[model samples]
Structures are given as C-alpha cells and as structure tokens.
Target: MSERLLHLGHEVVALVRPEAAEVVGAYEGRIGDLLDPRTLTAAVTPDIDAVIDVATPLGDQAADAAAIAALTAPLVGTGRGFVYTSGVWVLGATEDRTADEQSPVDAIEIVRYRPAIERQVLALADEAVRATVIRPGLIYGHGGGIPALLVDLARKFGAPRIVGDLGVRWPMVYIEDLAELYVRVVTNASAGTLWHGVAHPAVAVKDLAAAAGAVAGVTTEPVVWPVTEAADELGAPFAAALALDQSVSGAAARDQLGWRPDGPNPIVEMLDGSYR
Candidate 1:
C-alpha cells in the first residue's frame, strides 16, 4: 500500500516500531506500536492528509479502541479522510446468501467487538471526518496470508487437509486488488459509507486445499479436518472463522469507486503463480 501510494505521487508515512524503522524505505516512519495505544498519538499529525487504520492488534479490542480514539481526536472536524480496516468475518456465516454492504451483521464470536468499532469509526463522519469502513475478504497473494497456511498443512501432513465441512466456501481478494480499493476510498469515497473489498465471493475450501496439495507436490484428495481438532491446532476462534461459510459482494466498490480487480484467479495463482 505504501508503495502504491508513493507511485501515485502521494507522500507516504508509515507507523512502525523502532526495529522496523529502516523498512519504511522512502516513506517517513513514525515510531509507534499498535499494541500500545499511547505510542499511536503521534501517528496522525496536522500534515497528514488521511489516516488508514490497517493495524490489527492481536485481538486486543481495548487497545484498538484506545488507539483509534487517539488517532481520530486530532482529525475531528477537519474533514480529513479516516479509513478503518475490518474483515468479512464480522458478517459471519452467510450460508447460501451473498452479503452486501448493507446486510445485517450476524457476527461470530471472534469479531463480536468489530461491529461496535466499525460503528464508532462510521459515526466520525458526522464530526466532519470522511470516515469509511472497508471489509476485505480472505486476503491472498504473493505466497502469503491464510492460504499459505493450507500449503503449510499440506507439507506437514503430506496431504491436503481442510477445516470443517467440504461445502464451506470463503470470500477472497487479491492483496494488490484490496490495496487499490484502499487508494480509491482514501481519495474518492464519500463520508459515512461502507465498502466490501471482495473479488471472488464463494471460493470452495476443498478446491483451495487441492490447489495447496498440488503446490506441495502431493495430488492426494483433500481430507476434512474436523473443526474441533482444527481448533486444537489453530486456536478456537480462528478455526471457527476458517470453518465459516460466507459469500460477499464488492459491487459497491466497483459501481461507486470504479474499482477494477484485474487480478488473476486465486486458485490458478496458487497453483501456477505466486504460491508456486
């Protein structure tokens, strides 16, 4: 995201820990830590044109709320843009239905606090801040993210293993595509609006596992790892999230912000592109 912003002629300032200062490269690096709310006070200064809260602080909701308060207090009534990053897990299992931006949330246990945080961020629009919430699906690309975990599992077991039932599906977005949506929202979106950053809305987990197996040089048919056992290995909340079945739409982003996700197919990318 920083690179994209810089390539577009926008100045980039990254908030990082002291150890990561050198990693910011051409962008200015502000010393801070998301897990420590007090350190985030200097993240948004008067010269900052916009603020994007993409940091997820290890499920520490209190720290996240405090950090948000500190970041936005300086921008109140300034009409500056504030983008908060959330995830589709807040929508929970959509079952056979496809959820849009306006869908009523049936958030699961893991993200129960997210709805309140999203509401807090959206309410800032009334304070003259152009606050918007972006909910991205399972972000995958560059041989990273949750998909890579499946590849790891395939290598570990010498066979592909999927969590929960075979019918489970996930919403997906390429990393670069999701980043482009962030750029659009930062420069173009109206106040108080929400956007879904998904591309492929219903990717089957079995297919993903098979691709992962192929990547691991194993063509064995994927097996279902029960959610209970998965929880033992991957934590209860995240395992439940992996087991969720959801379909989400990014139409609002396309129709409103003119976002074009021209990325390669996720499964194909895993099989023959980045993940390879």
Candidate 2:
C-alpha cells in the first residue's frame, strides 16, 4: 500500500514495527508499535490530509480503534479522511452464498470481535473526519501470499494435498490490486463507506492448487485429509481457514470509487509464474 501511495503522488508516512524495516524499507517510515497509543499519535498528526490504518492481527482492533479515534479527534471539523483496513473473513463461513458489505457478520468465535470495531470506525463518519473501512478478500501477489506457499509445498513434496472436496470457492485479489483500492478509498471514497477489494470471481481451491502445482512443475491430487488431522498438522488457525467456504464481491468499490483492477487473476498468475 505504501508503495502504491507513493506512486500515486501522495506524500506517504508509513508506520511500521522496527523489525519490519527490511520489508518496509526507508519510505518515510516511523518505527513504532500499533498497540501503543502515544506512539501511534506521535506517528500520525493532524497535518496530514488523511490517515490510513492498515495494521493487522484481530487482537489489535481495540488499540487500532483507539488510535484512530485519537488521530481523528484533532482532524475533526477539518475534513481529513481516515481509511481503515479490515478483512472479509469477518463475515465468516456461509453455505453456497457470496457476501457483500451488508451481509450479516455471523463470524466464528475467533473473529466475532471485528463487527464492533467496524461499527466504531463507521461511527466516526458522524464526526467531521471522513472515515472509510475496506474489507479485502484473500490477498495474493508477488509470490509472497497463500498461493505461493502451496506452490512451494508442491515443489518440495512433488504433490499438494487438498483437504476436503476441494471445490469450495474463495475470493482473492492481488496485493497490488488491493493496494489500489486502499489508495482510492483514502483519496476519494465517501464518509462511512465500506468497500470490498476482491478482483476476480471466486476460484475453487482445487483449481488454485492445480495452478500452483503447474507453476512449481509438479502434479497435485486431492488427499481428502480430515479437518482435525489437517489442523493438527498445519496448526489450528491455518486449518480453520482451510475449512472455510468464503467469497466476496467488489461491486461497491468499482461502482463508488471508479477503481478497476487490471492485475492477473491469482490462479492464472500462480500457474504462469507471473505472480512470482
């Protein structure tokens, strides 16, 4: 996102953890933890035109909310914007249905906390600051995302395993495409608006695996690993994610912000090595 913002002629101030220096680089970054309110306030000032919160980990939602509240307090009545990044995973799993901004968030116990934070951020629209929340689908790109992990496993093990029917569809977007949505929301999106950042139509998990396998020069077949066994092997969190049947729509973003994603479809990119 920082990279894209820089390319868009915005003066970017990236707030990053000190340990992420190599990953974040020297693009006007402020090394600090998002959990610290004072640190966050110091990193963000009322002078900037907008504040974009892209911090992660659901545990940090409270702190992020607090920080955004603090930052916007002074910007209120001044017409500055605040763009907060959230995820579609907060919608949780559903049976053969696609979720949009208005969908009921019947999330699992693990991510049920997101709706409150979403509400808090949206409430800021009542204030003078323009606040927008973006819910991105599974972010993939640059050979550094989920598909890449599968490709690496395929290359090492010569075959990748799909846990279940392997027919579940998952929404996704390239990192660059997601970044473009963020930039658009910050610069031009309306107050209290929610946007989805998915690019292509939902792709089946098995097809995604096959695409990854082709990129890695290997073959793959569904192994039908039990959910419990997969969780035990891959750790509980990742296993739960694998079990989810999720897809999201980006119609609102396209319609509202005039944002268009021209990036490669994630599965095709994985197969063609263009993602790498």
Candidate 3:
C-alpha cells in the first residue's frame, strides 16, 4: 500500500517498530512504532491530510485505536481521513452462502477477537473523522501466500492433502489488487464506508490443492483426512481455518472505488508457475 500511494504522488509515512527499521528503511516513508504514542504524535502532525492504519495481527488494535485517537483528536471535523485495516475473517463461516459487507460476523472461535476491534474502528466514523474500514480476504500473490504454502506442502508430502470433502470455497485476493483497493479507500472513500477487498469469485480448496500439485510437477490424488486428524497434523489454528467455508464479494469496492482486479487467480497461477 505504501508503495502504491507513493506511486500516486502521495507523501507516505509508514509506522514500523525499531526492530523493523532495517527492512522498512528500504521503503520511502517515515518509520515509527504504534506502541509509542509519542512516536505517532511526532510522525502524524496536524498538517497531515490523512491517516491510513494498515498495521496487522489485530492484537495491536488497542494501540492502533489510541494512535488514531491521538492523531485525530485535534483534527476532528477538519475532514482529515482515517482509514483502518480489517479482515474478512470477522465474517466467520457461512453455510452455503456468500457474505457481503452487511453480513453478520459468525467468526470462528479462534478469531472472535476481530469483531470488537472492527466495532471500535467503525465507531470512529461518528467522531467526525472521515473513517473507512477495508476487509480483505486471504491475500495471495508475489510468490508467498497461502497458495504457495500449499505448493510447498505438495512438494514435501508428495501429495496435497484434502480435509473432508474439499469442496469448501474460500474467497481470495492478490496482494497487489488489495493494495490498490486500500489506496483508493484511503484517498477517495467517504466516511463510514466498508469495503471488501476480494478479487476472485471463490475457489474450491480441493481444486486449489490440485493446481498447486500441478505447479510442483507432482501427480497425485486428493488425500482425504478427517477434520480431527487434519487438525492434529496441521495444528489447531491452521486446521480450524481450513475447516471454514466462506466466500466474500468485492462488488461494493469495485462499484464505489472504481477498483479493478487484474491479478491472476491463485489456482490458475499456481498451476502455471506464475505465482511461484
């Protein structure tokens, strides 16, 4: 996102921890840490036109809120924008249904912590800041994402394992496309808007694995592993995610932001080795 913004001629200031300075220094932006309120205050001055919070892990929600509050407190009603990053995981699992922005979040037990953070960020819309939330699906592409992991697993295990029916559908987006959406939302979206950053309609897990196997030059059938057994093998967190069956639509973002996704679908690209 920072790269996209800079490409668009916007002066970007990114927040990073001290430990990440060496890596983040390669990017053309200011680096600071969210945990330190003073660092944020010094980085985001009143002259700044907008604030985009793309910090991750969701566990840093409190510090994010505090940083946003501190930055926007005096600038309220000044029309400065505040864009917060969220995830589609808050929508949780759906039964044979596709979720939209208004869909109620029935997040899996492991990810229930997301809704509270979403709510807190959404509430900022009422505080006179031009705030918007962007919820992105499983982000892939640029050689390292979920699909790549599957390809790696196929190479390691000699076959891509499929848990259960393997028909479960998951929504996904390429990192570049998602980055474009984030740039649009931060720059042009109105206050209180919610956008889904999905690109592909939906891809079946089994098909995705098959494509990954093809990319790795391996020919094998789906190895059906029971949910519990898969959980034991892949660990609870990852296995729980694989068990979820949910898809999301990016129509809203495309309609509102004039955003278009041109990136390759994970499965197709995986098979063609374009994603590697």
Candidate 4:
C-alpha cells in the first residue's frame, strides 16, 4: 500500500518497526511499535497527510482500545484522512449471501472489535476527518498469508488440509489489487464510506487446496480437518475464521472510486505462478 501510494506521486511516511526502517527504500518512515500508544502518537504527527493503519492490535482489549484511540485521535478535526484496516471476518459467515459494506456483522473472537472500531472510524467524519474503513478479504500473494500454509502442508503431507468441508469459501484479493484500492480510497473516496477490498467474491477452500496439491505433484483431493482440532493446532478464533463461508464484493470501491482489481486471483497463481 505504501509503495502504491508512492507510485501515485504521494509522499508516504510509513510507520514501521525500527528494524524495518531501512527496508522501505525511498519512503520516509517513523520507527515505532503499533502496540505502544506513545509510538503510535509519535507516528501520527501533524505533518502527516494521511494515516493508514495496516497493523493488527496485539494486546489485551483495553490496551488495544487505547492504542486504536491514540492512533485515531490525532486525525480528529485536522481533516487528514484516516484509513483503518479491518477484514471480512468482521462480517462473519455470510452463508449464501454476498455481503457488502452495509451487511450486518457476526464476527469471530479475533476480529469482534472491528465492527465497533469501524463505527468509530466512520464517526470521525463528524469531526471533519475523512475517515474510511477498508475491509480486506483473505489477503494472499508473494508466497504468504493463509494460502502459504496450504502450500506448506501440501509439500509435507501430500494433500493439503482445509479447516472445514469442501463447501467452505473465503473472499480473496491479490496484494497488488488491494494496494491499488487503498490508493484509490486515499486519493478519491468520500468521507465516512466503507469499502470492501475483495476481488473474487469467493473461492472454494478445496480449490486452493487443489492448487497446493498441484504444486506438490499430488492428487487434488482435500482432507477436512475437524474445526475443534484445528482450533487446537491453530487458535480457536483463527480456526473459526478459517472455516467461515464468506463471500463479498468490492462493488462499493468500484462504483465510488472507479477502482479495478486486475491482479491474478490466488487460486491460479498459487498453483502456477509465484508459488512455484
């Protein structure tokens, strides 16, 4: 996202760990930790044109709330944009419905606070800040995120295992496509709007498992792991999220900001492209 914003000729000031400061290449960066309210405040200085939070809250509820508030407080009344990163899990299992920005939330434990955080972000518009919520789907690309786990499992155990049955699916967006959407929202979106960052509304977990199997020279059949067992192997909340059947579209991003997601979908790419 920082790179894309820089590509659009915007001067980006990224908040990264002290060790990561050298890695942003040409962009200016503030060395800080997201978990610390003081560091977050140090990063969101008055000179910043916009603040994009891509960090996940990493502490207890009170600390997370405090950190989030510290991050959002500096932008109030200043009118500088605040782009809060949330995810599709906040909308929970969509069943047969294709969720949009206005959909009701039934979040898993990991992201239960996101709905409230998003509401707070939107309400910041009342303070004259152009606040927006970016609810990205399962972000996968460059040999990382959840699909990488499938790749690893396929290599080690032949058939890749999915958390649930073949019917389960997840909304997906390639990293580049998601980055472009972020740029669009930063430059063009109106205040108080929420945008879904999904490209393909849904992709079957079995299909991704098959992609992993293809890379490993194994059969495409998937083994369904029990959710409870998965919870132990992973975490309860993360396992539940993996098993969720979510489908969502980036229609609001498309219609509102003329954003187009041209990056390759994860299923095919995981099989034949970068994964190799």
Candidate 5:
C-alpha cells in the first residue's frame, strides 16, 4: 500500500534496512531497522506527514505493544494522521453475524493484543491525531501472506491442506483492493473511524482452497488435517486463527470513504490471475 500511496501522489517516506535501501526508488527512503526503537522514533520525525503501522512484531505481545508505542508516540498531538493496520481476526468467530465496526470484538488467542492496540490507536484522536484503524479480512495476493502457505503445501503435496473440516467461513479481500482501501483511508477517512477491508466477507474455506489448487493447476481434493496437526505444521497461533469462522461488513468503508473495490473476488483472481 505504501507503493500505492506513492503512486497516488503522496510523498511517501519509507524506512528500510541498509541492504534494502536500493529497493525504495524515491520518496526519501531511510536506513532503519524495525527492531531498533531509535530507528522507528527517528523515522517518525515531526516533518513526516503520517505514520502507517503495517509492520507487525513477532509473537511477543509486549514487544508488539512497545514497538507500536515507540512508533506512534512521536506522532501524537501533531494532528497528523496515524493509520494503524489491524485485522478481522480480532473479531473472532463471527459466523452467525456479519460484524461491523460497532460489533463487539472477542479476539482469538492469536491476536488478543490487537483490540487493546486498536483502542490505543483510536484514542489518539482525542490527542489531536487523525487516527484510524483498518481491519482487513484474509489478505491474499502478491505470492505472500497466509495463502502462500496453502500454495506452498499444495505445490509440494498435490493439494492445499485444510486446517479443519473446511466448514469455516473465511472472509477475504484481494490484495490490490486492500491497497485501494488503504489509499482511500489516506485520502478521505475521518479520525477515529474503523473500516473493514473486506471484499467477499464469507467465502467458504473449501472454495478458497479449491481456488488455490486451481492456481497451481492442481485438481486435487483438499485433505482435511486435524486441528492439532495443522497447529503443529502452521504453528498454534496461526492454525488457531485459520480455525475461526469470520465475516465482516465493508459497508462502513464503502459508505463513508467511497471505497469501491473494482476487482474480481479473491477466489477468482487467485485461481486465474495473480496467485499463479
């Protein structure tokens, strides 16, 4: 999305490691490390217009909070925008209902730290910061994120392995559409607002994996793996997340920010386009 923001004519200043300095073509890139507090603090200097926190920490919850506080503390009270990237996993198991921004959130164990950080992020509005949160559904594309696991395993073993019985509902969004939402938030959203970056909010996992199989030109049936074994292979935290049945409402984003994701649903694009 940083790249999209740059294309939209925003002067994007990105932090990068020394080895990656060549990757950032323009926009005043800087040499910095995510693990170093000084690097992040220095990067969010007063001259910067906004600070977007898309970089997530490792499994340490405390470390995550500390990293966020370090990055955002410098931006508070500046009335500058602070866009925090959150996820729908924070609204765990929304199977019976389509959760909106106002819906009560009970995050799964994997992302329990998110809700608190979300509250802290939104509270920045009170401190004169134009803070907003975007909770994206399963983000798939660019040969990365969660679906890469499916594609990788499928390539190796014939089909993508299912985490559970393939009955779980997985809300999804195409990567490009997700980038568009970020650009929308940067261009038009109000402070303290929350938006769901969802395209198809309740795509069945079976269909999702089937689409992934098609990406690899494989027609193999999805083999259901026991939750414990999935956890062992994909890690407990991530497997626990995959086991959730979630659906979210993108109406708030569409209505407020005029977000129109003019792209194919993730399943279609994954099967016939980018995922290949």
Candidate 6:
C-alpha cells in the first residue's frame, strides 16, 4: 500500500517502535507503541491528512481500543480520514451463501472483540472525522500468508492437509489487490462506510490444498485433518477460524470506489507463482 501511495505522489509516514526506526528509511517514521497509547498522540499531528490503523495489538482488545482513541483524539473535528482494518472472520460462517458489507456480524471466537472496535471507529464519523472500516478476506500472496502455512504443512506431512472439511470455502484476496483497495478507501471512501476487500468470494478448500500439494510435488489427494487434531497444533480459536466457511463479496469496493482487483488466481499463484 505504501508503494502504491508513493507512486501516486502521496507522502507516507509509518509509526514504528524506536528500535525499528530504520525500517521506514526514506519515509518519515514516528516512534510509537500500540500497546502504550501515550506515545501515539504525536503521530496524528495537524499536518497529517489521514491515519490508517493496520496494526493489530495481538489479540489485546483493550490495547487496540486505547490505541484507537489516542490516535483519533487528535483528528476529531478535523475531518481527516481514518481507516481501520478488520477481517471477514467477524462475519463468521456464511455456509454456501455470500455475505456483503452490510451483513450482520456473527464474529467467531478469535475476533469477537473486533466488531466493537470497528464500531468505535465508525462513531468518529459523527465527530467530523472521515472514518471507514475495511474487512479483508483471507489474505494470500507474497508467499507469506495463511496459504503459505498450508504449503509448509504439505511439505512436512508429505501431502496437502486442510483444517477441517474439504467442502469448506474461504473468501480470498491477493495482497497487492487488497493494498489497492486501501488506497481507494483512504483517498475516496465516505465517512462511516464499510468495505469488503475480497477478490474471490468462495474458493473451495479442496482446490486450495490440491494447489499446495502440487507445489510440494505430491500427487496424492489432499487430506482433511479434523479440527480437533488441528487445534492441538494451531490453538483452538484460530483452528476454528481456519475451518470457518465464508463466502463474502467485495462488490461495495468495486462499485463505490471503482476498485479493480485483477491479481492472479490464488490456486495458480500458489502452485506456480509467488508461493512456488
């Protein structure tokens, strides 16, 4: 997202820990800690036009809320843009049906606290801040997301494996495509609006595992590892979330912000592209 912003002539300033000051090299870096909200007030100075909260306070809901309050306190009545990142897990299982931006949130245990924070960010729109909430789907690409974890499992177990039933499906978005959506939302989306950053609404887990198996040079059929067994390795909450069946649409972003997500198909990308 920073790369795209820089390409479009937007100045980027990243809030970082003191030790990681060099990470933001050419771009301006302001030292702050999400866990310690006191250091954050300086980040949203009057010169800053927009603030994007993409940092997760691990699973610490209280810290996240506090960090948000500190960041937006400086922007109230300024009408500056503020974008908060949330995820589709908050929508819970959609089975075979597709959920849009307005779907009622039935958040799973893993992200039960996120909807409240999302609401907190939206309420700021009433305070004259252009606050928007974005819910991105299972992010895949750059050879580094959840899909890559499956590839590692395939190589380790000598075959592809999915957390639960092979029939389960996941909403997906390529990293670069999701980044472009952020550019649109930060620059043009209206206050209090919500956007779903999904590309493929429902990609079957069976197909995804097969792609991972192919990447591992395994020709055998993919395995459906039971959720209980997966929970032992990947904590219970996350295991349940990975096994969730969701079909989410990104139409709001496409129709409202003219977002065009043309990234490579995820299965193909895993088998022969970035993940390979």
Candidate 4 per-residue lDDT over residues 136-209, each given as its tens digit:
98988888888888878777777778887779998999998999988988877778999999999999999998
Model 5 earns a TM-score of: 0.92
What digit string (tens of lDDT, one per residue) describes model 2 on residues 127-196? Answer: 8778888888887877887777777766766886565456667789888888888888998888988988
- The TM-score, computed over Cα atoms with residue i paired to residue i, of candidate 1 is 0.97
Candidate 2, which ten residues in sequence have the lowest lDDT sum? Answer: 218-227
Candidate 4 wrong stretches, greater than 4 Å: none
- What TM-score would you give candidate 3 relative to the actual structure? 0.89
Better of 1 and 6 by lDDT: 6
Q: Model 4: what TM-score?
A: 0.94
Candidate 6, residues 29-127: lDDT per residue as tens digits? Answer: 999998778889877888899999898646888888999999999989999999999999999999757999888999999999999999999999999
Model 1, position 131, has a per-residue lDDT of 94
Steric clash pairs (candidate 5)? none
Which is the leading candidate under lDDT? 6
Worst 10 residues of 3 by lDDT: 25-34
lDDT for predicted candidate 5 compared with the true structure: 0.81
Better of 2 and 4 by TM-score: 4
User: How far off is residue 16 in model 4, in Å?
Assistant: 2.1
Give lDDT tens digits, candidate 3, residues 129-177: 7878888888887777778877777887899866655777778998999
Answer with 1 or 5, whichever has the higher TM-score. 1
- TM-score for each predicted model, relative to the true structure: 0.97, 0.89, 0.89, 0.94, 0.92, 0.98
lDDT of 1 by residue, 127-169 (tens): 9999999999999999999889999999999889988899999
Tell me the deviation in Å of residue 177 in model 4.
Answer: 0.3
Off by over 4 Å in 6: none
Q: lDDT of each model, Cα atoms only?
A: 0.91, 0.75, 0.76, 0.84, 0.81, 0.92
